[model samples]
Target chain A: MDARSLSIDGLPVPFDDGQTIMDASLAAGIFIPHLCHHPQFTPQGSCKLCTVRANGRYVSACTMPASEGMEVESNTPELNDKRRTMLQMLFVEGNHFCPSCEKSGDCLLQALAYELEMLGPHFPQFYPDRPVDASHPDVLLDFNRCILCELCVRASRDVDGKSVFALSGRGIGKHLIVNAESGRLADTDFSLADKAAHVCPVGVIIAKRRGFAVPIGQRRFDGEPISRRVDWLARRRADDEEEQ
Target chain B: MSNSEPSVRPATRRCLATTSLAGCFGCHMALLDIDERLFELIERVDIDRSPLTDIKRCGRCDIGLVEGGICNAENVHVLREFRRQCKLLVAVGACAINGGLPAQRNHLDLGQCLQEVYLTGPGIVHGQVPDDPELPLPLDKVHPVHEVVRVDYFIPGCPPSGDALWKFITDLLDGRTPRLGHPLLHFD
Candidate 1:
């Protein structure tokens, strides 16, 4: 299975043929921060947080394919600083009320911010005046908390076949959108069963009556940071792949 | 190919290829969540162009499972590709079937969205809005994938449970028209 070999951050690593740089790094136990790149999904180079220096050039670790004898630097000070800055930008761009969010303890963005020691967001907060649609009986849509990651949009469109969610605007001001004619979720055919609800990595979309189902002390993956989650997933992935 | 000959051959097993649109990989992942059946499914049919496999497009697939809604030009192209390659196109998740969350912006005007973020926000965007023709122009209204292309099957769920997907898949593979009368699968 030794298809190629690469050096990431000075550590020599072996990778299978067609393995992505992120997969190789993760296999070698190197930590690379990312949001949109899930092992379960297509490696979307959407979130640039996982950008790293590969062979002295900046490239996304998620989408870049690994090759023999390639040199990669994943956690250099400059790259970490850039990632931290980008994360902070995301923080200021959205109203991430950690205390009130259902996904607060389990949120990836929040945990990343903490890991980077983001004491306070530096950029001017874009306290966007967006609405919350509780129109559907089963789910809630709070546009204010959205990061425009396109996860929910992709999940709904690809997984659910509902095409219920979307991004309305462009660039920094972009926000998630719903059906046009039916401003309300109930008006359209959105239900409790839509995949869009799960794609929301934040509290932007929540199961209507399902929040707080687990007590604050007993919530799944609570108190654990996102990096830990990634580590756990990476371990699980290795085990799964090994079994395969 | 005999209509009435009592031959003991299994039903023609079909290969289904799936591609996601604007939604999360949740629905496709949910399909894998069937856990044990997932192992069996890979044996039963050929899986092509799925996020699981890095393949982008496939030709002449027996079934096409599409998730998410079409919001941009890329989505439209992908949907058309599936339609062309798949004989029986199935819209798998709520987004593909109904225009899930992104459609919410259809309530507001695109101009208002621009004003709030650029001209009205606290930060100053120094230059005029770049009128990029390549960017998928925000439609006046968001539409589901099926609205653009005719779909043969529909599976609905917030994220449809793996159990539901398995049932539908098994039925379809068995050459039965999977009946989705349950509340979670299809709502009439």
Candidate 2:
């Protein structure tokens, strides 16, 4: 395993030769805000939130491979502002009613907005009339909360070996579609145990009968911010590997 | 020389006003939830136009706090008035900042909504939509306060917590930018 060191925001991060900037940063316990680039699946680089300036050139960190002696800037004011605008666009593009949402405290999109101090949905609310599919007994698909990250699509395809979700259409007409012939989750083989069912970072694919079970103020990102949680998880994983 | 000198103190209480448009008065209640801090607030500022004061019109004020979305034509008029009168206007909650729950109606037809509530509702006695000219007609869709007028600041919560409001007001008075993050900036 050939390892090289790269600096992200003045912090030295060691990475494997083939590892992307996002992988290196996450492994080194640095939080680069992202929506689509899940560690388990192949990097898609769809959500540009993890975008960074590498040697004066802006590139998606999830897809850009880390190189030794390269200068990468992630947490700058300009970059964060760009990310905030992107988040604002996502907010208005979807009907994210955080107050009534079951995934309020746990939702990554809402958490990232909070992290960036996004004051409000700066863009006009599109309020597209997306449908809620509760056909599955174990899962509720609330399309309103979906930011179209396509994590479920990738996770189902690559990890679970079940392509239960996919993006349909393009531009403003783009949306998540069920893979079943009947266009319903129940018609498909999507169980609550599937990788796709757990990969949704928003309130879209919520497990039924467990709403508010963890309580409002006691959720994952409630006590500690997402960055801290990521750092803690990295450390815990390292500790587990050391024990093994 | 001291005996004939006139007192040189100017009345310097910052005037504050607040109003609710097309939302539940939850945000106003949250404002009142400032509780004992209301005494300190009153000491530093004068309540010119608010639900608490029951003032019909908003006079010229230092700050105006607006809650709820613009659902009707009257909301637009009042919001424009607030923008005109106040030096700094703050959209106080999710409703005022992003249309919140009422904006959910934007998905359906306004006529359908009116029909459901007025005519086809379970407990409808008259079974007809009200046609009084005195009532302000609703806009095609609910809009956040910023869509109607320039909002100087925003506090983005369903109903921003009492403490968050207190901190924001005090920060403004102390001549500092109100920093809403993490614990203070919950949309839910």
Candidate 3:
């Protein structure tokens, strides 16, 4: 009875102390359309995909602390329009060819684009020069598809205790870098078993030798929308946290 | 609104022109994938200039469905002509909207690509990059249809599914703005 509650899009959801708006919402099965947030990681609020209006002000749901009597708006026409713009920017800023990428159906970026009804990559494509590193026998690093979500950075540093990934440079020059001096996944002790390897939300981090294991039509977000998969993903992440 | 003029009440069937520029005709295949529904469609719209109809050029038409990215001088010329002939131009697929797979070479120099594929590539015996006068001059970069001509609508799939095209066609014929929502709105 002492638990405080906030309403997201007018849904009264109760939250225990210390939970962010995102934490309480996801725990209550409300998806905020975030890519940077992981259930177990300390939410860095880097991606800005979780932007929401808290008490009539725009703020990141993952970083904003839940407060009593706080009215938040997560799903609205204006908010979705802004989020759609973000997705479009994400699409154009990198070389994301969903038709060829192995992660097309399973890609969170592509699934979210479909859920939000993104018609095209609205902005001019950067077509940035990127490298494909296949040095690791078990993994492939295709930087062309990175969205700068930093999920792998978090999982590596916090969970695997490897600190193998970090964001380098500044401004548009900012990019993901391998921690090893040799600048390769194989140079570092990055096994396929690491949580970092499983954390990429796009095609950037791919497993080697196992392409199209599941057919595209049957893969994640192919039969159903990402909105429907949020609960299952949330539950899985929660289970992982409990195990830890 | 048809009067008793009878000679011509806009000819009933709206003329539709479709074309592929730098694409593999996969979008056209999707159009054909309309399958038996093609009969219902044929009754409504008349095919004007298309590879399917084997017409050389389209005259004034009602709607134009353009597929593929603009990658050469000929593509630009054809697209401009299509714009002049059609009242409403719809970019029909991922290539037409965002240059799709063909745009992957945007980062590399055109000269470099030609050099690698022809002159310097392995197992080549005196291979030379063709500069034939008959060939269309390549543009420096591939661009979406909207980048070249004003696109009235955009359908974003690698090649949109048959159901998606059918929905768009039915909506256009029914006087509703065509929208591919939810499951139909896909990029790959």
Candidate 4:
């Protein structure tokens, strides 16, 4: 297999011929924070979080395919500030009650905020009236807590063969919705075992009865700051696995 | 469902073909990431027409694994083709089984969003909208594969966990009916 040489932040790197810029960056030990583009999933490019300067323009590192002589910059104060804005956009768009949620310690969205030094959501909270759906008897749907990452949507639609979950609105006012016929989760053929349930990056889609089962600090992603290699790798792995 | 039923005989090693419509490939990649089983899968099931394979379509296959929701015209056509050729059609991720996250955007008006993105938004290259034949046409709504075509099995996960994927494939190979037991295997 032929490997193409590319430059990221002026550093020369070799990328597999067909690899995406994100893959090349990860393989070369450069971590670009992203919420939606998981390694296991196809690059959606929906979340603008992973936006990086490729050549001269800002392009999503996850979706931009690696090519010969490509110039990439994973980090810069400007990029970091832009990403911080994106993180704030995510926080304000929906409910992200970090203090009360179980995924607080290990949540990627929360960690990204911390890394970018986002003290508070600068934008006014959209605060849509999303109801908590606990009817399934297995998984919980606290729409308020959802980031609308579409991981669940992709999981159900792409991975699980069940197009049960979807993001309903467009632009800044989007929300994840149930199927067409029933409009309620229980009405659809969806069950607790679907990929959509696991795809939620926030506490929005919680397991029905398992909210407090695991202590907050002991959660898989808690305690350890995301800056360390092991934790960083785990976050990267989880980002790739977020679809699950 | 009890696990008391004895295991069944395995079939001849064959190929697995997969396609994804409006979705990310996380679940599919997670399927491959079942590291231990992955080696055995490479040895046993020949992967064809997969995203990794670079082959979009193939002549024949034992299993057709579909990921993503059927959102557009192309998706419907692809789903029908997969239903047509494969012996068993498996909805391998949340999207195929339940319409997943991309379906969330389905609740909004397609025309309005198109207008926002292509006409009035910040990144529009062409300011004036063209009503010519060359312009991309929008679909009415996004639907799941099972709605359009019959699906034989469902693998559930955000991206289905490695253990679940391995079990699903091995069960299919061994002629056992895959059970949609847990929500993690089947909701969101």
TM-score of each: 0.52, 0.94, 0.93, 0.53
Query: Residue-wise lDDT of candidate 4 within A1-244, one digit each (tens)?
Result: 6667888878888888678888887777777788886665788888788898888888998899998998888678999999999887786566555545666655778767656655435454453456677777776677877776787888788877988888777776677788857577777878766666665666766766666676754655444444443334434434533433
Candidate 4 versus the native: TM-score? 0.53
Q: Order the numbered candidates by lDDT, best leading.
A: 2, 3, 1, 4
lDDT, residue B85, model 3: 96
lDDT of 1 by residue, A127-146 (tens): 44577888778887877677
Q: What share of the true interface contacts does each candidate keep?
A: 0.00, 0.87, 0.71, 0.00
Off by over 4 Å in 1: A217-222, A234-244, B1-188
| True lDDT of residue A169, candidate 4 | 75
Pairs with steric clashes in candidate 3: none
Q: Please write out the lDDT profile of model 3 over residues B58-112, one tens digit for every residue.
A: 8899999999999999999999999999999989888888888798888889999
Which should have the higher DockQ, number 1 or number 3? 3
What is the Cα-based TM-score of model 1?
A: 0.52
Candidate 2 C-alpha lDDT tens digits along B1-188: 56876866544679999999988999999988999998888888989889999998999999999999999999999999999999999998999988989998999999999999999989788797888999999999999988889889999888899988988998898888988766887888
Cα lDDT over the full model 3: 0.87
Model 4 residue A38 distance off true place after TM-score fit, in angstroms: 1.3
Comparing 2 and 4 by DockQ, which wins? 2
